[model samples]
Target: MTVTTDIAQRQERRERLVLDHFADETRQDFDAVLATFAHPRYELIPGGEVLDGRDPVHAYYLQTRRAFPDQRHEIIKLRHTEDAVIVEFWLLGTHRGPLNGLPPTGNAFRCRMIALFIFEGETLVCERVYFDSLTMIRQLLAGVSPEALPQVLSGLLEKVPAQTPAVA
Candidate 1:
């Protein structure tokens, strides 16, 4: 195959892998989602959390699913770069279980996110995500005005300094 065609094929595979990972996550298929990673790892930029390896990643998934049983994403865009597939998406879910010492409010949240599906060649090594943490806190808290979000988030953030930021 020509160099151009080979590169295109690689990009296609990476794109497919990213989509498959998202699908698996939405389905809550742990094994399939884990299979997408050649070297599984996640980075939560604003949340300042890092989880590597299958065990930790699985636990993170469980913790999140407990809090938001219907957590899923709606992709807005996907950009394939030389080293990563960047995705812009909206995460939607309802608070069903305890999260960060906060009881379930039965409130729902839809937060926009941008994530980098970092890779080594075609092997996905990490999925690093960035999003507004305050939006989620305010949303889950129910009817909390944006005016008071800073004070509310400041106190809550300290309590949950290491929430696994999800948007893969």
Candidate 2:
């Protein structure tokens, strides 16, 4: 086989793997999702969190899914590069469980996200995801009742740092 042909074949395989990974996540089939990863890693950019092994990654998945049981993605675009497949997508979910010390809001959020599916040869190594946390947070608290606003606001403030960075 020619070099160009081999490159094309590799690209096809990566795309297939990425699609299967998304499908498995949407299905909440954790085992299947883990199988797709070479070492099972995730980098949540917004939260500055790195889950870099099977156990930690698995636990992270469980925690997030518990909070948003119906979480799923809608792919907007997929672009392949030499070492990564960058995906633009919408992450949709309903807040049904406690998240970050806050009680369930029962609100649905659809946040646009971008993820870089980094690969090692033909195997996926890490999924580095980027999104605005505030967008999801606002959506989750949008339906809060007037009576609950104070309590909800208080909970949110607890999660925020007391000191704010000065403008450069």
Best by TM-score: 2
Give the alpha carbon lDDT tens digit for every residue of 1-168 in model 1.
899998899989999999999999999998999999986798888767888899989988998999999999999999989999999999999999877666677899999999999989979999999999889877898866668667655655566664554544
Q: In candidate 1, how many clashes are counted?
A: 0
Q: Give the TM-score (vs. native) of candidate 2.
A: 0.88
lDDT for 139 in candidate 1 is: 85
Assess the local accuracy of residue 56 in candidate 2 as a C-alpha lDDT between 0 and 100.
92
Q: What are the Cα lDDT values of the candidates? A: 0.87, 0.88
Model 2 agreement with the true structure over 98-159: per-residue lDDT tens digits? 77667899999999999999998998989999999999988999978889988877876676
Query: Residue 131 in candidate 1 has what lDDT?
Result: 95
Checking candidate 2 for backbone clashes, the offending pairs are none
For residue 137, what is the lDDT in candidate 2?
86
Alpha carbon RMSD to native, model 2: 4.0
